[model samples]
Each structure stands twice: as C-alpha cells, then as structure tokens.
Target chain A: MTARAAMGVLLASLAGGAGYADELLPYRIEGNAVPVSLTGKPGDAARGRTIVTNRTLGLCLLCHSGPFPEERFQGNLAPDMRGAGTRWSTGELRLRMVDSHRLNPDTIMPAYYMIDGLNLVAPAFRGKPLLTAEQIEDVVAFLATLRD
Target chain B: MKRFHALMCAVVLAAVAGPAGSADIPLDQRRSGYADLGRDTKAMQDDDTSNPASLGVQDGEALWSQKAGTAGKACAECHGDAAASMKGVAARYPAFSPARKGPIDLEQRINLCRTENQKAEPLAFESRELLALTAYIGRQSRGMPIVQSDARLTSAIDAGRKLFTQRIGQISLSCAQCHDDNWGKQLASSLVPQGHPTGYPIYRLEWQSLGSLQRRLRNCMIGMRAEPYAYGAPESVELELYLMWRARGLTVETPGVRP
Candidate 1:
C-alpha cells in the first residue's frame, strides 16, 4: 500500500474503533467516580486464565506476576499472583480488582469497572463507569480462579 | 488547550509560594525532620540486591552491548561506550526532543531508537527488555547531575508542574503531597524524598532490573491509587518533564544500584 493510503487506513481504523469497544462495555467516567456492576457469571478459573492472557481481554499479566502456561509473559513488578486465591478471599479479590482504593486507599490499581471520575474529561466519561457491569463480573470471575 | 490553561492559571495562583510550616508535626521536629528522613531513606536503600532482581541488571548490560536488529545499531553504536557514553543522559530526559517535537523520557527515546534505528518493535513498558535497557542506560550516569534544561521546554514544564500538583489518584495524594509537603515523611518503612529523578534507568532492587522514569511514574500512580498514564503517552511525557524540572539540581545517577 502507498504511504498515503496506509496513513489513511490507519486513521480510518482508529476513528472507527474509537468508542466501539464501549458498545459492548458501555460505561463512563466522571472525575473520581467509581464504576461498579454487581452482575455476570462467576468465571471458571481455567476459562478466566484464557481471558486474562488474551491480548484483547483482561491482559492482567502485563504488570502482574501469575502462573500461566505463558511463563515468558509474566511481569515481575508485583508479587506472583499464582497463589492469590490462597491469600485473598473472593470478595477481597473482587474489590481489589474492581476498585482497590476501597481497600488500600493508597493503591495504584485502576478502577476496572469504576471510573475515578475526571470532571474535565468528556461528557461521555463525565459520570459513567469505566468497565461495563458485565466485564467487571467476568474479570471478577476470572480473578477468583487464580488459585494454584 | 484554553480550558487546560485556565485550570493551570488557577492552580498556579493557588500554589503556596514558599515552604510552609508543617501543619501536622511539632514546630521543632519539622526543622530536623527532612534530615532524619534522609537517614531513613539511606537505610531503606540497603536492599538485598544480590538476588534474582540483580540478575536483570546483568542481562540489561548484555542487551545494551549486543548488536542486533536490521540496522545493526546496537545502543552502543550511537550511545557509544555504555559506561562513558550515557553519563548524565537519564537525568536530562523527559525533556523536549527536537526530532520528535515533544517531551520524551529516556524509555520512549530508547524505544524510538530501537524502532526507527534498530528496526525493532517497541518493548512493552513492563517487558524485561525495557527493564534491562533502562537499567543499563541508567548505569551510564551513575554519579552525574540530573541537570535537565531547555528554553523550548516552557510549555511542557508548565504542564508537568500542573500534573505534579494535581491530585488525581483515588488516594488523593498529589506528587506534591509526598515529595513536596512531606519530602522527609515516612510512609510505612520508606522515606519519601523530594521525588528526585536521580539514579534513573537505575537498577531498582525491588524489580531486580532497570526501569525508566515513566515506569517509576506509573508505579507512583499505582501507589497513590491513581489510574496510570499509558506508556509513551503525552501525559506521561509532560509529567516527566515536570519531574526533571523538580529534580533540577540533583546529580544524574543513571544505572545506579538502588534498594
């Protein structure tokens, strides 16, 4: 493809993909607002791992240590997540992933489904949550299965 | 841009010009407080670096010296000798790049070199390669002054300064709160410095490898319970520039051993 054409294609792709993901995970963010969805299937640990490792899914291993078939991909920044289930209760894990500040207040973790509202952000994220209710539940289910 | 400027104007107006007496601590204790904090920080620096984490630094050194990629430009080619070549490089970064026309920290600069010069894919922020490269690069300026400055950096400096003072994390602790308001305060076992940018690209004993300024900022954001700026994003660059300015007088300690 010509350079100009490629540039056009890239721009078009970006424009098209801009907020489409939100269609499936409809949510918003307003300054410091938290997004919590009390909904979804409790994910199977095995299935959750697939999503966690999936490049388009949770992508948790990007900054977290975890036991997975993909050993080469684990990050060393945090403690190994292999035995997380042994340490944290399911409720604790859910809260930590969903919005860690509720627990530690000083944690650097993002509000998965919650939007730590940015009043100056945009109208779309002004008062909405970040993760859709369903994605939060899916991620929660996945986190629950991190035993061993 | 206008709104952001307006926000900045308000912030600058609200800034307490000079250091104020500590509201929480006793008056006399506040005087020697910073000095005592320094001692505590030095103590925390005594990490057991003789472990797996230290191994990452060795790998980074190897990677820094290795000549791979299509252009055959190992970092050594342009950077020259790692030990002598990178002196004071890390501290001056998050500064404006004439070529890129924006502020870029050392990690992004390295990635730009890799992708454009080496013809390689950019490493992810948390990747081992990025960590190793950061460590090796930092090692080059172990004892130099951070000394970041440029006339073209006014706007970036302003933006970064705003970011440093703005409280965004769920914990509501701005960079200023810890590094400015309580530079010598103890947060658990750790003593907070003025958030100096010295010894960057240094081998952090905790991660057991070298990390870039952006990585450190991201970690700080996590520590503050804030959403991290994405790797290589403009916000991160702006923040980096501000940090460089904040640590202006500190010497560069790139690739230094840290606990």
Candidate 2:
C-alpha cells in the first residue's frame, strides 16, 4: 500500500470510529428551546416517524405511548405523545429532544444528545449519545406532527 | 365518644405505619413480579416436578449432607432436616450479620456457613453449586412471608431506598421509574412488574438456568447501561435487603420459573 493511500485508509477508519462519535455540534439553548436546527435543514417527518416507532433505534415507545396504531405495546412511563405538537413549539421540542434533564433533573428520560454527567455508561457506548443530531431533529419533527 | 376516640387512635397509628414498602401503590395493587409472568411460566413455577429449577433444588439436597473441606462437615450435620430448620430462614435473609458488621445476602450467608463451619472455600458467585444450594434453602421458605426488620439494617436500608430512586447510567433511569411508578404498564412488549424479590434462585427462560437475585439486579443495572455492582458488594446486598423489605408481606416463591 502507498503512503498516501495508507493515510486515506487511516482517515476513513478514524471517521468511522471514536473521531466521528465524539463530534457533537454545539447547539444554543435559548430559554428552554433550541431556536436553530442542528442539521441546518428541516427534518423529514416521515423518516422521523420511522425512528420514533423503531424498537431499537429510538425506543421512544419504550416509555411513551403514541399514535402508532399498529404497534401493540406502548409504554406508560411518561406522558402520551398525542397532542405534543399542540402543547409545545418546534423550538421547545428541539431542546427536549436534545436534553430533557435541563427541563427536569428528576426525569428518567435519557439525554439523546449529551455525553456528560452520565454514570457508568457501557464502554462500547461511552461518549456516544443515544441519538445523533440529525436523528434528534427527525424525532422532533415527527413528535411535532402529533399536534392533531 | 369512647369508641370514636379509640378508633381515631388506631387510625393515627396505622397512618404512621402505612405500607411504605409498597410506597404509593396500594397494598392490594402491589402485584409481585410473578403476576407479570406468562401463564405457562406461572404453571411451571407452581409444579415442582415440572419446574426446571427443581433440578437445582435436587442438587442442593445432595449438597446438604455431602461432607466437604478440611473439617469434613455437612450442612445437614450441623442443621439437620432443612424442612424444619431451614424453614423461614431464607425469607428473613439479607439480614444483619455480626461477622460482616453489615448486611449479607443469602449467597454470602451460605459462604459464611461453609467457611466457618465446614472449613471450605467460599463458592464463586453465580456458580451452579451456589445457585443449587440457594435454591434449596430458598425453597424451604417457599410460601412464607419475607420478614426483615433488624435495627442494625436501618442505615443500609435507607441507603438502598435512596439508591432505588437515584438515576444511573447514560439512560439515567431509576428503579422507581420502571419498577415502582410505572409497574403493570408495558415497556415495549414486556409488562413491567413491581419487582418484589419474592423469589431468588429464579429460573429465567432467557437464561435457561437458575440465577440469584443479585444476578438479576446486575442485569437490571446493565439494562440501564450502568456498570453492575460486584457480586458481594455492599450496595448489592443493601439493595437486596431493601427489595426484601419492599416485599415484606409477599410469600416466598423460590426456584420460581419465569419467561
């Protein structure tokens, strides 16, 4: 392998591992809301719905009941997802999607976009948030559509 | 007037001693983890002959009288006929231990008995041998109410109660969130139980083997993405004690089969 090619390979591996996982874009929280978008683009509500209802990726249904009629089991830990959009503005939802702990310290909801202040996170998942910035926007968009 | 005064006094005492074990869930509504189990699993637990954990029970029976160690003593020799002597013993465990100067779970108690009386090495945690013995001893207390009210365990129990509500891990979930507040509600496809420690050496379908309450607690911590406490850690024993206290009036269902 050539030196230039080897450098390229190393860069690729770095991008795929901890280097990528640790890259969390700073977002401003303004009065219980993130007024700006993380991806600099509006999220796809349809894609957001998929993330919300997925068993593994999002696990939102693990604690919150929602309008997914096909999903047989829905959690009762948190408030229902119905009418969420009607309850809060898009910005407020965005802040919540990032870190609900800022809203309520006693909340059991995990910080989807935070890496600090967590206790004993598994080694494999260390420094990794439960959701990426784009994924958080997607979920926020889907939750916002629950206004009806 | 006299009758009303006596009734009011009784009410005041009852209020002072309300079922703090159940916390907020009414006494009648505090369902055991067994209730959340499937019908087939419940059936399996009910029938000792059919229960897979019964195998562990048999293993324990064999170990009871089998002499071992330098002293060459058997548990049965010291405490003969588990039916009589061991009855209700396991139910009150995670009790105060004079030797440890702290709380010790049933597994630790067995090890203590082995080392002190039999002059044997302590069995490893989560080992088949220890599970078997624990199952046997736990079975002896089957159907008996879990009783634990030692004054020495006050601080430890208080710590456990605090831990139960304290959030942990990246998920930042607490025991009270899932097992205490939202119990009987569905978490994905599984029904969350109140998490009473009525059964130890329980046979889980996922494991296809019997495991101790400590093992189960470790699994729960892992579920929260938190590092689990070491087998004989003080925190783990204290948590076990608090769980037993939470399940005070519940009947023991050792060697319980669950899916």
Candidate 3:
C-alpha cells in the first residue's frame, strides 16, 4: 500500500476513540500463531519504530532499554531489548504486546490492547485500550527488526 | 552475539548481587523524606534562612491575622496562638469529618473552616494563600508523628488501599508498583519514596514552591497517564487517608524540601 493509504488506515483505527467498549480478540498462544489483522494490511516498520520510541505512545523505553542510542535516558527497570527480534518470534511478541499478564501475572508492563478488569481509569479512557490494534501490530513489526 | 552474552552476564550478576539488606526497613516502618533527602536539600530544610517554604509560612502567618469576610474575624481570633492550637493538627488529617460525612485533608478542612467558621470565601486548592496557610498550619506540626486512625475511616481507608493497588491509565501503573514495590529504587534518575504523605505541603524544587498533597497526587496520576480527580474530590481524600495511615508513625516534615 502507498504511504498515504497506510497513514489513513492508522488514523482510522485510532479514531475509534476512547468511548467504545473494547471488543475482545481471540488468538492462540501456540508458537508462530498469527492473529487476524485489524488493519487488514501489513504494518510499516518506520511507523512501528515511531510508536516504540514515542514516550506518550509506546513508553517501552521507560522500563525496557533498547538499541536506540540516539534517544537519551533509556530506563533500566525491565530487560533490555537489544536483540528482541532473535529472542522471540513475531507471534510471541504480539501476545506480549496485547496482554503480557497472560504470561506473567506479576509484570508491571501495561497491556496495550486488553481493556477488561481495569481500575481508576479516567472517564475519558474508561472503555478504550491504550493503543489501537494497528499500532500494536506496528510495534510488533518494529520489535521484530531489532536483531543486530 | 558477544554483546548479547555480555548483557546477559551483567543481568545475571546484578540479580545475584541483589540490593543490600542493611538499610532496608519494613514498609510499615520506613523513614520520611526528611531522612531520604540528599545533604544539600536536608540542610535547606534544617535552616529557615535557606528554606523556600519558610516564605510561605511567613505569608500564612500574615493571612492568619488578617481580618476577612462579613464576620471580619482573623483565624487568630477564634483559634488564638497557632503554635499551640494548630500544633499536631495536620498530622491527624485526612480525618473523618462529620459535616462532610467523609475523610477531609488539611487543605479541605482549612477551606471548610474558612467558609463555615470564618464566613469567608473558600480558598481555591493550590492557591498561593491556601498553600501558604496550609504550610503555616502544617509547619506547627513539623516534628509530630502522622496519627491517622482507621477506626471511623475503615471504609475510606479500604477504598484508598484499592486505589493504591489498582492499575489504571494507558501506562497501567498503580501507586504500589513504583512507591510500594520499588520504593528506594531508581526510576529514570530519581529514587522513589514510599509514597508517604508525611512531607506536604512540601517544597519541591521541581515545583519551585509549596504545594498541597493533592497537587502531588494529581501530578502522579498524570504521570501514570490517568485522569486526575478534581482538587476536592473524595477519591483524592480517600487516597490521602490511605497514605497517611501507611506513614502512620513517620514524623510530619511540613515545609519539607525535596528534589
């Protein structure tokens, strides 16, 4: 798809707003299981990289250090992601992004997609998930390319 | 591959060499920010001359005596000698209030007194005069231990505890995640204190002024990407009650200096 079309799809996905209740998605945890794409298209790694580095969006660097040396002040709270691509498959990365609590009940990482069973969420964000499904796919795509 | 191996080794070594246990105190018996402050900031709090919050206390003292409203009564007129009357008062708040039928912090209590007792307009939360008066009143309790009671505030305290542990916002962090679980651990570049309410209205260099405890709470909520409650919201008061109870025996360090 053209860059403009990709941007249009991303904007449309995000415009779902915070009002609608989150629709649960079904996916298997088996190795290399690919969930159905909400955006109905491949993700752009450039956009994915932007989501991973943006503090307001991804905030991955707040806890997890990555290979982005240009970005100063990466956090040391969680494991570094220098070779994330080689460490985990894209499907595994997707599950972690969607709902990490399924894997580890005690993780401090936020679920970028799942919205059920939250507390004290702002009225504006009561039912909405943090990132759109396309954005999660974009981040997954970006993490898949982190192999050095 | 070599870099990855080195990184793994560093992680393993760090895990094996866990944080020292010598200075680690149980969560219930932690020290106040006064003890956690760096040397320079602690010195600033020790000396009135260098303490910026002292200026607010001075302003608050003036406001205490100034006549206001139709009644034209100063805070000193009814509650004469703040050094004595106000002493240890701050440490007992967010206490249960019969009138409000809920928990009320020192800030809200002051506002209630202004509107009901003094017949004056209630000061806006975080206003200069409000913070000044709060700092002044709180300063009187400087070394007094925080004395929150769960006797009449069990429900409110319980609610606050839930809020403390409940994850919210886009970032999905609860107060316990940083302040409870990782207190004293470095986040970004700063050490996370045990989320106590012992040193407010505190003098934060980041704020460059004295601010109410609610202001600090709102800042945390925003940082976690959660929508903050309104200044006088009961949820904020509930959270304050929980924090005060959590810091039960810690001495009040009003006009506290923090980085």
Best by DockQ: 2
Candidate 3 retains true contacts at a fraction of 0.46
The DockQ of predicted model 3 stands at 0.30
lDDT tens per residue, model 2, B138-251: 999999988865656767776787778777776878888788777877777778888888888899888989998888998889888888888999988889887887777789
Of all native A–B interface contacts, model 1 reproduces a fraction of: 0.00
CAPRI quality band, candidate 3: acceptable
lDDT minimum window of 10 residues, candidate 2 chain A: A14-23
| Cα lDDT tens digits for candidate 1, B1-259 | 7777666544533442223322222323332112333344334433435323345557777888787678876887777777777766765777568886778877787888888889988888868888777766666665565565464666677677777766564344567666666655444345555666665554565776566667788888875546778888888888877766655556564444455
Please give the CA lDDT of all the candidate structures: 0.60, 0.84, 0.79
Model 2 scores a C-alpha lDDT of 0.84
Which candidate gets the maximum TM-score versus the true structure?
2
What does the lDDT come to for candidate 3? 0.79
lDDT (10s digit) by residue, model 3, range B48-150: 9999999999999999999978788899999999999999999888888887777988888888888888899999989999999999999999989988643
| Best of the two (1, 2) by lDDT | 2
Q: CA lDDT of A73 in candidate 1? A: 51
List, for all models, the DockQ compared with the true complex.
0.03, 0.50, 0.30
